[model samples]
Target: MSFRDRTHAGRELALRLVERAGSGHLIDVLVLALPPGGVPVAAEVAGALHAPLDVLVAGEISTPVRPETAIGALVADDPPLYDRRSLAMMHLSEDRLGDVVVGERNELHRREYLYRGRRPLPSVNGRTVVLVDDGLTTGLTATAALRFLRRHGPTRLVLAIPVGNARTLSSLRDECDALVCLQQPPSLHAVGEWYEDFAPVSDTQVADTLHAFHATA
Candidate 1:
């Protein structure tokens, strides 16, 4: 199944989530999206559940030579999550990735500040947090974010995505309390392949989405 766009995917995904929660009441649920792609999808979920929307700043640490290839990901105030399998295949070690970690860390903090203004981060203690992403690919970023949030002691953690690679979902679903994925394609291709309008989400778009959701919530 192909989604029209992130918003359309968001609406469809929200319906499943609402049904899962029963009666559409999610008072303890906090919706956190991994920006900038996750923001648009998350806006719809936040609207549906009447939950506060926020950004969880995490970044992919691209490989040294092939910048498009992610070797790992870094979440806020946490050590970079290196893909052991990828690192072994590349014959790379954590020591050789100092520069990549530094760069992604800088970017991660920048996005955190840019997405969130003066408002303090919402307390996650004892809350059922639903982390949203537009799509799941390598799963490194989502894993890192989940690990990072673990320190905050959330009552339960859920990973929600519009579409994902089937292989990745199998592994990730077990990591979170629950996983809400609309599609897990068997043929395993790029996340964008599942969407008809998989356009790049801009910084302004991320900010606007959060602003719009927060205004209503």
Candidate 2:
């Protein structure tokens, strides 16, 4: 199934989570989005669940040749998570990606600071943390974000996405308490293929989304 856009996909995703919440699967919920693509999608979720919306900046590491590829992902100051198979196939090593990691890490920090000024990440201990993203391709970034959240002592961690690759979604099942994916095609060539409007989300859009949420919250 294709989505009209991120907003439409978000509303649809929220319906599934609301069912989970109704079943008592969610408690003391806190919605954390992986910006900037995840912001608008998550805004709908945070509103539906009456949960606070926030951002958890995670950066994708890729080589200059294939910039769209995600060889690894990093969150906060934690160690980067790499796809070993992908690395081996590409004949690349973590050491070789040092410069890429540094660049992505810097961008991650810049995004975090831009979306959230001096404010620190909200506490996840004993709370049900829902990490929202637009969609998952390799799922490296979501995996990295989930691992980072896992260390923070959350009571339950959930990963929600509108669409993703079936195999990739299955691989991430162990990372969170629950996984909500609307469309899991046999093979996902590109995430944009499943969305009618897959435009790049700007930094200004991310900032404005958070600002609007906080204003009401």
Candidate 3:
């Protein structure tokens, strides 16, 4: 199925998620978005539920030889951890692991500053935290985000994405408390291919969205 845009996809996904979420007397049910692509979709979800929204910054560690290939990702303010088996399967060198981690951490820091300002990360302790992203492809970014959030002691972690590859969704099932995803195409090409309006979300838009949320809060 094709989406008109990310907002359309998010609303549809949110409807499905709300049904599964059930009637709850809950606390700190924050929606954490992975910027800058996830921010737009996450905003719609947050508005739909009247829940607080925040950003979780992470950066993909690209393969040195094939720059487009994401070996893994590093979550902001979190210790570097990698899937040793995946690295071995990819035939990545142990010597390059440090460089990859350092480079990804630096990029993650840059993204953190770009997407978030002085505002502190929302406390998810004993709270149901819904993590939203536009789409999941390789799952590196989502995995990193989950690892970081686990440290924050959330009661539950619900990962919501508009669309995802089947393999990627399956990989995340064990990592998250709940998974809310719409379409899972057999031959997943790219996340942009599923949406009609697949424009890149800008950092300025992310900051503006956060500022608007803060003003209203």
Best by lDDT: 2
Order of all candidates by lDDT, from best down to worst? Answer: 2, 1, 3
Off by over 4 Å in 1: 23-27
Q: What tens-digit string does per-residue lDDT give for candidate 1 at 1-217?
A: 7899999999998999898778533448999999988988998998888788998888888785778888898887788898898899998999999977888798877877887876767889999899999998889899988888878999889899999988888888767888889898866568888889989999999988888877766
Query: What is the TM-score of candidate 1?
Result: 0.94
Off by over 4 Å in 3: 25-27, 81-86
For 14-113, candidate 3 gives per-residue lDDT tens digits of 7876676566633457988999889888888887777888899888766767777677777876765565766788887657688777877887777777
Candidate 1, 108: how far from true, in Å? 1.0
Candidate order (TM-score): 2, 1, 3
Q: What is the lDDT of residue 152 in candidate 2?
A: 98
Which residue pairs collide in model 2, if any? none
Model 3 scores what on Cα lDDT?
0.81
TM-score of each: 0.94, 0.97, 0.91
As for candidate 3, its clashing pairs are: none
lDDT of model 3 at position 51: 84
Tens digits of per-residue lDDT, candidate 2, 1-217, equal 7999999999999999999999999999999999988998999999999999999999988889889788889999999999998899999999999988899899889888999999899999999999999998889999999999999999999999999999999999999999999999989989899999999999999999999988988
